[model samples]
Target: MLLEVIEAIRERVGKDYPVWCRLSAMEIGVEGGITLEETQVVAQLAEKASVDAIHVSAHLVGPGRRPPMAQPPGTFVPLAEGIKKVVSVPVIAVSRIPPELGESVLQEGKADFIAIGRGLLADPHMLEKVTSGREEDVAPCICCMTCLDSVTWRDEGIWCVVNAALGREREYELKSAEKPKKVIVVGGGPGGMEAARVASLRGHKVILFDDGDELGGQLLVASKPPFKETIDTFRQYMVGQVAKLGVELRLGERFTVDLLDELKPDAVVLATGVIPFVPQIPGIEGKQVLLVSEVLFGAETGERVVVIGGELVGCETAVYLLQQGKSVTIMMRGPELATNVNPLVRVPLIGRLKTKGASILTGVQYEEITEAGVTVRTETGERRTVEADTVVLAAGARPNTDLLTSVEGKVAQGLPVGDCVKPRGIREAVEEGYRAGLTL
Candidate 1:
């Protein structure tokens, strides 16, 4: 598979484009996989193929496999050394290589260059900081994998928890704008707040409006989970940015087209977010059914809980409930679990869930929510019931596009963003909002 991929790349980009093959040195305990010797052989083959570099690291996938990030940097040094011996071209060593370790690898001739993925994300200009003798400015990655989690919960793409502006380069700016205009942003959520901040920074008169008292849309609910306080940092930073940029903020004011007409700004950005999907399952309304958002942001639940849907949100909510000492059984109508989740976070999370004894049932349609638990029908003509005290529905969400539809073509310069445009993560929301703000 690796050779095929490399060959295809070579075919398209030509031999001089510097195609490097990155692979795992060893799977640790896994059998019948690439060993250190095999890795060196592969590196030799790549060198023969005129590959630019051979990047080696430890990789582990599938259930019961500990990720490379979980292991120490020393564990991969031997593998790097082994590959370096055979490969004539530059060899790249990866897996949590700190500056000290990177320096040692370079000094000992184990590898030509140290490749740091998350490390660079933790500080995009890390090399600049290091070269200028200002290593203190380089933000160190905690390796907590919250950045991985953000891809799942916040949909903000890959980002370091410590570095607020990692994936937001396209959204946040420090330079002055060539053409700035007055902008009115509705909703103080991630999208709205971001739009206001970007517009104001670009020398535009900006006003951010939100019916809610505080900023942060669905992010507020996401921050409630354990070890997810880093999400709040983004919200706080966005709010602070708006204030620092002198973007006018109006809280607890409902947005209307009439109000927008009154403001008569240069542009209007709508980021109203989304509404929870209320399923019409039998006895669903009678039971204490709460949206995943409610359960995530609200109080604790009963000892036994049944989560409807097994997507990323449902899986995370189930994990959160299990962490709170509640018995969680997730019911999904699909064959797979957490399909929407990022592999980096999902792999580890599913492993942890297995250790914690959480139950997941897929390929089963939710029939109803009874007094005892949830009744589900399997695809194989089997009826199974799971006991639960609290039933949390995380089926999905509906875009709150009513306002967008109502105001469509009504305003001279109208733009729909965030969940109102489509129910997605903060990354899409902020990106769309930033684009809308820039257009203004």
Candidate 2:
């Protein structure tokens, strides 16, 4: 049937237009999956059918398998190289192949062409920026999996976390402001930096402030975990953008009412982020208790660790600890683990935790925290003690609205963006930040 269809299409097109055959190079997580050698045979057959090019791709065969979109750059290049050797046709390597890696793939003679799908969706000008030696200007795809998860699981249109002007291109088109205003954006997270970037691009005199000495509020700690360093790349890109655009940085400076009055800016955007919320329980303030950020930031942990909370932060922290050869037990009040995380990420994350010998418990009630470990009431109301040397808190966070409350009604245009509006992830932060800049 493959040969018949190819012949029919060739006859219809009069052999003038090119026809590319997309083939799966390998099937992951399947006992009897298509192997590279089998794909090589298929590639030979497809080439014999007079196909112009062979697009090499890969697929995950079962649940809990890692999504290709979240994999590292040039993940499928090896597959393309395998198929290329079997067929004389040009082989196209794809799946999260960033520009730099794609260039290296070609120079290594792995594939004749590189296809960038989600990368282009994140930034349409990626190629132009690379060719012009302005690679930093290109918005990056952080592999957050929000774009693919929205379509596959949520049945929604695509969205990019880093690039806010994705779907509504015309609506977000940056036009020079007829009258520029002085803008002061507080909190140097994704939202605040993005607001500064966009506002300055529109001819506004923008000044960004953060309490920390360096930028990238939560992102600095977020990137510390394994398989999440792409987020740090995004953080670097944002920092460079704000710097290049001439947005004045006031690091290690708190944006208090006095500072607001002193600066006297026309507008104020609060991207103040969030504060960690530790549940109330006996011995909650013990010396052994540490926040998830603290653990990811290199705080020493005991050999046996108990993680309280099974959401995205909690689950990822368990993975980080498990990788360190520490015994980990994840305890959550809710019935599910990583319920807030996107399925594309949550599936593989939970798999990694389980594979690394991390125990996960749900429907838990915190009774108390003792020196030995955590005391909890199980789903059946049975009191039990989980042994641990250190207790890591990963429950959740609440919006930090201290500055927003202080500067209420003081500035002419006041906008609270990102997690300060409500505790959410990078998507909400970047989108809200972009919109806040446009509003000002």
Candidate 3:
């Protein structure tokens, strides 16, 4: 049947045309399909049938059983190498193989050719940029899984956290604005920075405002955790891109209706992000109690810390503190922590937290924060207080809509991006900002 398909393709394209067969090396079919040995058998069969080359790939069975290529850079090299050893045909390797890594794979004779997919999504001109000695300009793919998760979770099309113009390339491309409008972006986060970058690239005189002295809003905190160092690179890239594109940045500037009127902009983007959601818990206002942001960006903390809310932020904060030589105990009302995070990021994170000796207690109810620590009761109603010098509120956050609400309808285009629209991650924020910039 495979031979028949090859012949049909050869006939359609003519005998002189090349016909390459792409197949999964390790199929995840329930009843068992193509194993690695079977992959060699298929490759031999295709070779005998006069196929030009063989492209090897693997299927993602489920959450933990990720396809090798999707897992990491050069992840599929071993699989491709194994297949290449058994096949006479020129082998093509794929899946997250960037140019630099691909060059290494070729030098090692892993495959005859390297094909990149997601790498291109980050920077369409990645090859051109790298080859032209502009390696710094080539946006890197951190394998954050936002592109795939966006499709599965949001029912939305593709979006790159690093490149906002992934799917909407034509729509969000840097075309000169028809009318050179004045743009005021109220926020120095990823979303606001992206809006200003695109708007500025399109010839709009753009200015960005953020209340905090520093840019990168949630990203500032998100980048501080372990195994999340790439987020810092991403933040640096976005901030640098906006700066290079000439977005006038006003740090430590609070946005107001009065300030908005002072700017007198034709377009306004409110990417004010979110404020920490401090629950009305007993003793939440204690001196020892602090928000996650405070622990990360502001407050000086004690050696022992109790983190409330075992969601992504809570778990990550616990990990961060643990690395800081602070003992951490995280309490959660749910059955598990970081359930909302993609498995790629969550699994390793949980593993690292365990390795670092961070305590995670789930299916627990928060009673109150005490001077010593936080009191939590299990499902059985037995209360136990975890001792700590600091109580970090990693619970969650609420959208900051003060500026958006105040200046809504006052501008020609009043756009809300990032956490203002919804408290999602970098992907949603950047995408919304880029699309909104296109409209302006």
lDDT of every model, 2 decimals: 0.77, 0.89, 0.82
- Runs with alpha carbons beyond 4 Å of true place in candidate 1: 1-116, 119-179
Q: Which candidate is the best by TM-score?
A: 2
Cα distance off (Å), candidate 3, residue 333: 2.6
- What is candidate 2's local distance difference test score? 0.89
Clashes of 3: 0
The candidate, 1 or 2, that scores higher on TM-score is 2
True-vs-predicted CA distance for residue 272, candidate 2, Å: 0.6
lDDT of 2 by residue, 197-250 (tens): 999999999999998999998889888888888889999999999999999999
**Model 2, residue 148: C-alpha shift (Å):** 0.8
Q: What is the C-alpha lDDT profile of model 1 across 206-311, one tens digit per residue?
A: 8888888888877788766554554675677677677877888888888888876788776788889898888888998954777888788775578999889888
RMSD each, Å: 7.1, 1.6, 4.3
Going through the candidates in the order shown, the clash numbers are 0, 0, 0
Q: What is the lDDT of residue 410 in candidate 1?
A: 69
lDDT string for model 3 (23-98, tens) is 7888653356668888888888888888988999986543334322235567667778988998888999998787
